[model samples]
Target: MDRQFSDRVEAGRVLAAHLEHLKDRSDLLVLGLPRGGVPVAKEVASALGAPLDVLVVRKLGAPGQPELAIGAIASGGVQVLSRDLIEQLHVSASRLATEIEKQLKELDRRERQYRGDRPFPDLEGKTLLVIDDGLATGSTMEAAVRALRQHEPRAIIVAVPVAPSHVSSSLLSAADEFIAVERPQSFMAVGQFYRRFDQTSDEEVREILAAHTHSGE
Candidate 1:
């Protein structure tokens, strides 16, 4: 209920402590879920001395309730839907198609805006640490994990500052390992845990990635 972190940067530092074992592992790679996740992940990558990259994912929220995710789409055309939610909502096929198309366009635009000419990092046989500011539904993270699976990462670890205690089972099953700094029972939203939860912009995401890339060079 109380503010657990001053901001995403602080959250990342706290998470890095718990993930200290992964520090300096050549096989490890840190992939952040942009745009909010990038700042947190930047700290994690710095702490771990690993390469950092972004995994673009868009949440497909339910009709009329944009905050409630019905599914998610990730890079490389990987899509994951909650069939139960879809059936329960009775979301029309046309509506779902339109949403998916819209999100896919946004994903593509983000990829171009963030990475520019740089190619996506290779994940084959690597240990991936998927970082996010926090998790609420876990749908977007699940989509990211499924997409990464196609590249055959040796392992996938989903790391976040906070998440609902109830989403643990699903996230754990989705990733090889899942770590949450705080799993509160009374979790309402991810932003509530932070004292300053400002929206992360596309420009910020680009700058962070550029800085990380330069530091690596």
Candidate 2:
């Protein structure tokens, strides 16, 4: 049976339930990949009673196919690329460089926009829950996990609302643990499982973070 969520909120709640054992852990911190991930992470953070923050990641889309991610870059100058995909796609060196530069700029912009002058939260020795709406190719989420590893967190749990079974399994090695609300066999896209999978705006991301930040303070 295919599981469908009314929206990210409902999906997040379902995902949070699976994480019940980790509820209220002192060292737990939740980081959502904006802007879609923020809403889902907000619900998870609320359900778990953990502080919430954003982890900005930009997909390094392939040449001539901007929606297809050949790699991804995250905060702290961390990047993960699929060389096999790039080679197969025959992405030119100059074009690849251009894509990286563009995404890096966007990544920096998002980090500043969502966070303003606030410094990124310290995660040393903490157990981080990194949330996203879903995973299609899993490149972006993989980049996020690799980047967060540099901060030396005790563990990283990658959680999402929906993803292909294989895609979720592939990320298992990147993250300490992986959680997904649904892994349907017929999955073609993340939005297919949601009744309302709207694009999350920058304003929405800021508002969610502001609410969490103030509540944390």
Candidate 3:
């Protein structure tokens, strides 16, 4: 049985319901994985009275199979690669280096475009809630957790609307807490759980962030 929501807003609202108990946590911050995670994060932040920010993670796609992530990189040059995958796929050292450089450039470009001059929130001793629309491959989410761990947050929680049971289980070990609205046995793709899985544009992301900034001030 495949249950789909009306849109990201609905998913956010639903996911937020699961996190309502954390509303009173003063040191909580929400970081979304753009460009799909911002809108969802906004709703979560609004509901929880937590500040919202973006966590840009660029996937280092495998050679030829671009969708398959050989490795992933997050902001501040946090990189994680699967050595087994690299060895099995026979990815050359030079080729891996090239992809990493490309991903780093993209990570920086996205940070500038989406969050120009906005300093990353200080996660030290804060309960950081990392939100995304959904999880697939789980590599990107793992990379995000790894990057955030560098900041020494008091706790880390990975929350999403939907993810495969297996992927969600694997991700639990990476974060202090992992919560998802639904973990189906036959999870196919993230889009399958959303009726409106439209590609979020950069302009939309900018608008949302700007609106939040203005409202907060």
Q: Give me the candidate number with maximum lDDT.
A: 1
- The TM-score ranking, best first, is 3, 1, 2
Residue range 21-47, candidate 1, lDDT tens digits: 999999999999998999999999999
Looking at model 1, the pairs that clash are: none
State the C-alpha lDDT per candidate. 0.91, 0.88, 0.87
Error of 1 at 148 (Å): 1.9
lDDT of 2 by residue, 1-217 (tens): 7878899999889889988888999999999998888999999999999999999988888878888888888866678778999999999899989999998899889988898888888889999999999988887888788778878999999999888888866799899999887777777888888899999999999989999889972
Cα-based lDDT at residue 119, candidate 1: 86
Q: Is candidate 1 or candidate 3 better by lDDT?
A: 1
Provide the lowest-lDDT 10-residue window in model 1. Answer: 73-82
Candidates 1 and 3: which is better by TM-score?
A: 3
> What lDDT does candidate 2 reach at residue 164?
88
All candidates: CA RMSD (Å): 2.3, 2.3, 2.0
lDDT of 3: 0.87
TM-score of 2: 0.88
Q: Which regions of candidate 1 are displaced past 4 Å?
A: 1-3, 61-71, 81-96
